[model samples]
Target: MALPKPGTPVRGSTTGRPIMALLDLLGRRWVLRILWELREETLTFRELRERCDAMSPTVLNQRLRELREADIVVLEEPYGYALSKQGRQLLEALMPLQRWSEQWQKKLAAKADQES
Candidate 1:
């Protein structure tokens, strides 16, 4: 089924703010991972599945469908699946978040070491 657009109620969101909609979609299992995996190259369904450590085909297909609907990914001839321009832009936008996560990981590790 097609997902509701921004400004309409979506899962966990009654206000339907666009950011909430985006977060709801991204929060689904494997969604962010799928996008991250596609950052560099196009991959066939099987390749993507393998890269995702053999995620269930059913879930992968579902996530791909949702991404396509969101205009973040596309299926192409000969190339299988690749990120669309919008997807690339989104990934680029996420670079800062990626950097932040690396720092956050280090901080957590340090805290864990101190506690231990």
Candidate 2:
């Protein structure tokens, strides 16, 4: 789908269509994890990799590029990726989803145990 203009109200989106684009970006492999890792503090490329359980450097680099292009991530003076203001806002917005995910995880685990 053609992306909505920046700052345009994302049609068909309560949060707006722009948010769908956001979700699409975050849904990519390791993208959400990268954001989660950046939540506490900014880290150098190597540091990000280490905290990411040593994800392949190639994959990490690619995600960073996509995030930067989307203005959800920025490379700081010291050469570490940090969330842009918009990115921080997006992360904060997802807090409720994070709680929901934890609950979902527990529920699935319980179901698996029962099945076993």
Tens-digit lDDT track of model 2 for 1-116? 23333344454455546556566666678989998899878899999999999999999998898888888889997869999998899899999999999999999999999999
TM-score of each: 0.91, 0.75
lDDT of 2 at 110: 100
- The backbone clash count of each candidate, in order, is 0, 2
In candidate 2, which residue ranges exceed 4 Å CA deviation?
1-16, 108-116
Pull out the clashing pairs in model 2: 10-17, 13-16
lDDT of 1 by residue, 19-81 (tens): 888888888889899999999999999999999999999999999999999999999988899
Pull out the clashing pairs in model 1: none
lDDT of each: 0.91, 0.82
Q: Worst 10-residue stretch by lDDT in candidate 1?
A: 1-10
